[model samples]
Structure formats: C-alpha cells, structure tokens
Target: MKKRIVSLAMAACLVLSMMVTLSACGGKPTLEEYYNSDAMQTIITAAVSQYEAQGVECSVTASGDELRYDFTIDIQTTEEERAIYAETLESQMPADYQEFIDEAKSIKESVSNETVTVVVTYYDADANVLYTQSYSSDG
Candidate 1:
C-alpha cells in the first residue's frame, strides 16, 4: 500500500463546512498550459521564494505537469523549534489524520492518473492552519 505522502495541511483538512470562497475574476494562467514545463528548479524556486517572503519554511516535493508533477509536501516547523511542535501535534493529530485520509480517499475516487499540482504551506504558529492548494490539468 502506497502511504501516499500527503502534505501536513492535507492531513489537517478538517474544514468540510469551511469552504474557501474564491471569486475567480479570471486572470491566473489556466492549469492546462500554465505549468507544463520541466523547469522544476525554477517553478519550485518561485513558489518557495513567494512563500519565504511571508516568513515561511517551505519545500516543493515535486513538479511537472499533465505528464508529471508534485504530489506531496512535508511540513517541518513553523517559527520556533519544530521538535516541540511536532511532539504536540503528533498526539493531537489523530482525528485530523482521519479527516485528511477521508479527504484523500475522495480525491482518489474522483481523480485518475491525471497530473496534479500541489503546494502545502504551514503557518509559522499553527500547524493545523496549513495552506494546501491543488491544481489539475486544463480539461
């Protein structure tokens, strides 16, 4: 069984009733043709740079497009020592883990081998308050 390396945010995705309301006024590049490149270093650098500006610790797991792309991101620490935070979350993340698993199962049910774009960001103070975003091909 592939222990899908789900991102920390994805693992804490318990906001079923809390939906992100984005009023897409149309402008961002289409998922289809936007990230279809092999310049992973460039792409990752950009994402990391943008996030780092906001005082974030980041790591881009993978990158590509319809053919290949990132699937998971591991969150290390927020602002201070990660050891303490990780220890605390490890004990309290069970329920969140279950919810995250359920969410991944749903995504698996709905998605195919379709390449996905994912970015996982953990808040410096709150491990549960992670920012995870996924992008699918331009269908």
Candidate 2:
C-alpha cells in the first residue's frame, strides 16, 4: 500500500506538470487589431484630419508585413519651397540624388524627402501569425 501510494503521487505530479506546460498564455500582438483598435485608430484619424487641413490627401494601409501611409499635398510650390526644402534636406540626401535633377524628377522626389514614423502591431496564435495592423500616432 505504501509503494502504491508513492507511485500515484508521482503520477499526479507528472500529469499536473504536463498540463501546465501544454497551456498557452495570453496572445500575440497583431497589426490588424492595432489599426482597428479604436484607441489607436482615433489618434491616426485626428492626425490625418490635421494634415488634410494643409490640403494634403493621405490614407493608411497595412497588409501582411507591409505598412504604408500615403500622402499627397498641393502647394504653390514656388522655387522658394524647393530651395528651402532642398537646403533643409541636403544633409540627409543620399549621395546619388545630391546632384541637381530636372524639374520632373525634382517634383516626383520631393515628398520622399520628408520622413514620418508609424507604429504597427503583429499578432500570433497557436504558433501561427494571425494578422498585422499598422497606424501612425502623433508624437
């Protein structure tokens, strides 16, 4: 009887340990939820609204691991804007584009001269990545 009791106790301990190890805890963070999340979504919407006030058209899109925030703006775009922007962005420009460009290329690459930060989330479940969502938050 003593031996039998000892064996049963060991078995219970093993079973309990196994169950604990098999259980999954919490959840993986995902981008879909981040963009869809009301809190984060609201922040992005407000920022976009402010940008729209400047006559810029923009929207946020996320798919898989890719995240994009597209924006287009209309400006009087005098030589002053380009000159000022060029001077401001001069230090940051890559060696390739450091030289002068034709008017067409200058206008095309102008927006690329600016930078913005966006925060996104990715979620995983059952050892598989579920979805990704992205949104930009105001600093």
Candidate 3:
C-alpha cells in the first residue's frame, strides 16, 4: 500500500508540472499590455539614449491595443539617425511580441526638424488610433 501511494503521488506531481508548463506557453500579451511593461520602457529608454546623441525627453502612453512613444532630442536629428532609431526600436521588440508590431493596423512616426518634436503613434487591430503624444528636445 505504501509503494502504491508513492507511485500515485509521483504521477500527480508530473501532471501538475505539465499543467504549469502548458499555461506558461500560452500566447503573448497584447501590445497595450506590453506598453506599460518595464521591459518595453527600458528597451525604449536605452534606444533613445543611443540615438539621440545629445539628450532626449520621452513619454509613453497606452490604451487598449494602442501605444505611443514620444521623445524629444536636443538637436534636430538627421534623417539617418531617425532611420537607425526606428530600426533599433524594431529590433528591441521581444521576439514573441514582434507579431503585434507586424499585425498592427497602422504605425505613424513624425519627427520635426523645426522644433525637434517626435511623435510615434500605433493603432490597434481594429483601426482605432491607440494614442498620440509628443516629445521635445533641449535645443
């Protein structure tokens, strides 16, 4: 009877472990959820510091399936720098979350040379604009 109980307990443990593993493999979080995540913010902050050259102020806002990253650089960044920044942002997206970026309804990025305002807007899958915000530079 003792041996039988031990075997049964081991089987239960195995089943519980499998259940936990399966739940962990569930689908990734939505873009809106990830927008507020520390991981995303850290990645964006690092990328901005890398590309801004001088200095930048950044703000992030998110609602539902929408996310906005707004930043300002001290100087009027060159087009090359903007391209690099965008690419770096793309690369920083976690692999599992890349699908959210790919399937987004729209992505709009505007950088102004006159005032050094940067605005990035991302729309949800339903064609609704998630959010729009602005960034400023010191210069």
Candidate 4:
C-alpha cells in the first residue's frame, strides 16, 4: 500500500510539471495578435493625432511582422527645399526616434521573442517620395 501511494504521488508531480511547462510556452501572443490588440490601436491613434496637429499626415501599418510609418508633409516646396529636406532626413533622425524604437522593442519583447523592424518613409506635398529610413531590433 505504501508503494502504491508513492507511485501515485510521483505521477501527480509529473503531470503537474507538464502542465506548468505547457502554460509557460503558450502564454505569449503572436506578433499579429499583439498588433491587432486594443492597446496597440490606442498607441497608434495617439501618434497619428499628434502628427496631424503638426499639419503632417501620418499612418502606421503592419507589414509581415514589421511596422511602417508614413508621413506626408503638407506644405508645398521647391525642388531646392525638397533636396535640403531629404539631406536633413538622411543626416539625422528626429529627437524622439530612439524613444520610439525602444518602445517598439519593449512591446515586441513583451509579447513574443520575435524581432521587429521599423520603416519610416517621408512623402512630399505632391506625394513624391522624399526619404526613407529603417530601424531593426537586431541591432
């Protein structure tokens, strides 16, 4: 009778350990699931509103585990001005660029172990592409 009780206890422990392992592995959401979550939508909406207040049209979209930001300048500019703007974009990023990247990485890590890439594209007033840049979590 004592041997039977010991065997039953051991079996129970094995089952409990398996349950724990499965739960730990399945707790994290996929990239697409997190991207479509309400919390992510709130972040995107706030960002869009802030850019709109500055007279720039902005949008965020998901592209195969990557995030894309598109910003359109509202004011018309001459070719020289556009050239200068493009040069500036290539030289330096906005002050909040790093912050944005950090937040993206943090959120992605929290949801899953997958890495994320962020792409930024700037458009002129006439819808012509002016500049493009990308940031990756791998670095």
Best by TM-score: 4
lDDT of 2 by residue, 18-137 (tens): 334433433322444434545445545665676677775557664443345555444444545555644544444334232212212321222222222242222122212222222222
Worst 10 residues of 1 by lDDT: 14-23
Looking at model 2, residue 91 earns an lDDT score of 42
Estimate, for each residue in 59-92, the C-alpha lDDT of model 1 and write its tens digit: 5443333222222223545445555654564566
Going through the candidates in order, what is the number of backbone clashes in each?
0, 10, 1, 0
Clashing pairs in 4: none
Task: Tell me how candidate 3 scores on lDDT.
Answer: 0.44
Tens-digit lDDT string for candidate 4 (24-117): 8777655556556565666567668778988999988876667788999986778888899999888777765785687567546655647877
Model 3 segments more than 4 A misplaced: 1-25, 73-139
**Each prediction's Cα lDDT score?**
0.38, 0.40, 0.44, 0.71
Residue 43, candidate 3: C-alpha displacement in angstroms? 0.9
Which ten-residue region of model 3 has the weakest summed lDDT? 106-115
TM, every model? 0.30, 0.37, 0.33, 0.69
List ranges where model 2 is wrong by over 4 Å: 1-25, 75-139
- Reference-based lDDT, residue 3, model 4: 49
| Model 1, CA-based lDDT | 0.38
Q: Which of candidates 1 and 4 is the stronger one according to TM-score?
A: 4
lDDT by residue for model 3 (20-124), tens: 543486734444444444544554555455445545455556554345565544444445655665566556544525333432321211111222223464333
